[model samples]
Target: MALSKFLGLFLIHIALLSSSCFAADPFVFYDFEVSYITASPLGVPQQVIAINNKFPGPTINSTTNNNVVINVRNKLDESLLLHWSGIQQRRSSWQDGLPGTNCPIPPKWNWTYQFQVKDQIGSFFYFPSLHFQRAAGGFGGFIINNRDIIPIPFGSPDGDITILIGDWYTRNHTALRKALDAGKDLGMPDGVLINGKGPYQYNDTLVPDGIDYETIDVHPGKTYRLRVHNVGISTSLNFRIQSHNLLLAETEGSYTVQQNYTSLDIHVGQSYSFLLTTDQNASSDYYIVASARFVNESQWKRVTGVAILRYSNSKGKAAGPLPDPPQDEYDKTFSMNQARSIRWNVSASGARPNPQGSFRYGSINVTEIFVLKNKPPVTIDGKRRTTLSGISFVNPATPIRLADQFKVKGVYKLDFPSRPLTGPPKMETSVINGTFRGFMEVILQNNDTKVQTYHLSGYAFFVVGMDYGEWSENSRGTYNKWDGIARSTTQVYPGAWTAILISLDNVGVWNLRTENLDSWYLGQETYIRVVNPEVTNKTELPMPDNVLYCGALSKRQKYAKKSRFYVNGYLRKMAVKTNNG
Candidate 1:
């Protein structure tokens, strides 16, 4: 009997240990400090805001469903908020770093962000979301690896590479914000950058000396997974490798049909994964170039950010001559054709591809439709603002999510229009509310003459269709009813409209705004509230205990009386007093 009992206890101990090993999840912690550092991207010295004194901040590598905790200490004079781009903070929207949903950490204060990267696997990034701070740096990549249970669609590459492409400005971020605040338009960029360095040429012959170029090293006859992200504040970039082909694999978190292309157009707030084989001549290096595309046709020139793809065995003092890329930056036909070719890979492993809640969106019933039309700039309350559907959004005196949770009144309105209004632009708060678990569609119509890119927080959407002119009932026939790709950010061409379908599976306040920093800062944005249903916790979650309140909410909380109150058998008086007083 003694021996039997000892054996039983040993088995139980072994079982517990096995379970713990299988269920272990990593917790990533980062200490981020926002400060100024001198760097030269265009060979001209300038002060840029950096995190931990490193420009293009540190990359946070994590696995799916892992918890990420970042302690941010603000050292700048301005308020700072960091947004995890393309991260669907599922059932944890309070962790999303948006000004309308969370309070910023003031100078010298520390704020901690704790959330799980649930059910997501892809190449994403993080950047500052306030006061045009992104242009001055403090951005980094957030890469999430897939779970062991899931199989990747493509073959495993020998290595992985990340390239961040963007346009650079010589002026300080504050000066640019001041110019925009004064209603002056920010013209073209001084130069473009690839991984924070590039060549800048003033006039035709005056080129900056001692320019550092970003270099990529690879072995001959080896394949690599290249994760490319367009993190620019403005302008669309076309990435290409001279004399080489690219096999596209994924976008954001969705597996896409592998297609071959020589060049790819990546708009702001977008990311893509491609398989690049270093099958070229190993004796010589090649040029990898990224240039501005779809800008003003008359002003289109050879403004490009270049890097060298050097072989590991090659020895060379110079990388020979630069290879030529397509000079037609204004080719609308080519651009649109490339955009239409991106489709979800139905045959990929673990891909649902169903008619509802999957790649094929045929049987999915869109419960609501939001028609957002972009109008020209207009002066409102002595400031030039960009209007979305005739309303230029104004920040409330408190965070919308906090106000909703505490039942604060007059913080925002729930009756935002579903269609654009005709007439003069007006300064107003635009917010649309939807029932939890309701599938919705948003149609973005660009009425102006420039390309527009928009990003949605807390969720990724299926890009169903895009077409020229205004969207109407007749436009439904042109929609990509099947095989629409899922992405967090998408672009709408000039005089065209883009349609995206999303499910309100996450209950919280979300922001839908332009990726263009100028337009976003000038009020081309709005919020959406997902109301929780009483039955299920799948779409709704409990409020985090450590959330910070600011603005008017802070004042009310400070002056409110705290007394004993009980309704649900727990102490609810603190929340009641702060919300009601």
Candidate 2:
């Protein structure tokens, strides 16, 4: 009887081994199924394409610069494509997975992608690019260059952790795309998700429909990496390792000067990674907390899911309850001001051929009526004729160019003032003509006494500064604070390109330079006087340079009906203490 029972147990073990998940080996061709998963909370299967029901699909580990072949099969009805947004391709540009760059794989079709895994030795991501599928429920996963060594803040068990931040909408992706394709204005996201799960489904039991509500487990005396990416178009999130401070390791896959914080602010189209170490020899249970950056006006805002990090008893004690996230963590003042400013413009113009390729129009093509009767076909002006309302053109790639005769020193400041954060200004028609006639005022002041060449990072621009009008935050009285920053006279140029640059020590030296272009023109110089700032007398690092900026103004005065050009660029990079700032 004992022999028989032992044999039966051995047989069961064999069966379980056959069904257990095995780590995928390198260079092995793999196939995955993308489908809906019937979750317990809603009793409805979520439409997720999964490798073995894993929403993140699978973690891929490979050596430096290893080439991998992935055979992706679209099990769903929609056409699917894959994009590596972060990975810089070596030579094969066609593998970029852009819609028109190459063809998208049709539904039920299989496509083989060949690319070399970069050896940069950092954490990366891989996801799906289906017809509106990524926004919905199609793909997720991370890629690692296991260089026989791992990142810092390590321990034995539960030593490292990676959190993938993303958002999800319950509405069908196809349906949503249809609305977007139809030109309907789709608003914000309904929910923020972390790793394809939400708190209500992961840890909240009060919600009767919760699914797989397992708290995240973490051990004390261990370190982990929280890899974050905001894949959703709508919701922005601030995530924190509950009760534990985090050290930022990298931003956008590039290492930054290490800084510690209890939480991180993640914006749309941004990714960040954090390294966190827990107290060794402490009680284990830990939570990864997530919250929306802002609560919508509507009641019952969505809460992102939670995870538990369980540690061994010998590891340590449970940390105190998670602290409240900092209220101003998501403030634009903090995130926007801290970064070096890189600026460019968005244009609504026609495409023109250049040395390399066609300068693009708008991202998409949309039409509108314009009343520019005197405008020349090739220039912003036709025999100095004025415009009423002009054509409304839309495309993502509209090429904005620098003016034929002017050089922008650089972008200084973009002030929206406390009031009128949204909406067009009065005298709209006058502003349009004023700006078109080079009457828009753009002020640049050099606070630094030492000379430094400042380069505006993105999009080319024409230099124009002319007096147009006075701009004040309050209508009750005029303030001198807005004087130099708010110029009455300015230069009017098209709005396709946004950012400009300036020399640090030179009071009013406007430099003419174009990046990504090799030609220089003799007529491209503008003479504008620089006004000194009255607010402060000292010139030091990080002091307000006192340069105010206004764009897309038809006239230097204010927003008007005729100021029709699109202003799309945001400032991104600013270099200090460099010869070519």
**Predicted candidate 1 versus true structure: per-residue lDDT over 275-355, tens digit per residue:** 999887766667787878776534545357878788888765334444555565555567776888999886776423122
Model 1 TM: 0.88
Best by TM-score: 1
Model 2 per-residue lDDT at 191:
54
Best by lDDT: 1
Model 2 per-residue lDDT tens digits across residues 132-162: 5666544454444444454432322244445
Model 2 misplaced regions, further than 4 Å: 1-30, 40-44, 146-158, 182-188, 200-209, 280-284, 294-300, 314-322, 329-331, 337-581
- Model 1: CA > 4 A from native: 1-24, 200-206, 296-302, 317-323, 327-331, 350-360, 535-538, 556-581
Deviation of model 2 at 165, angstroms: 1.8
> Each model's TM-score, in the order given?
0.88, 0.51
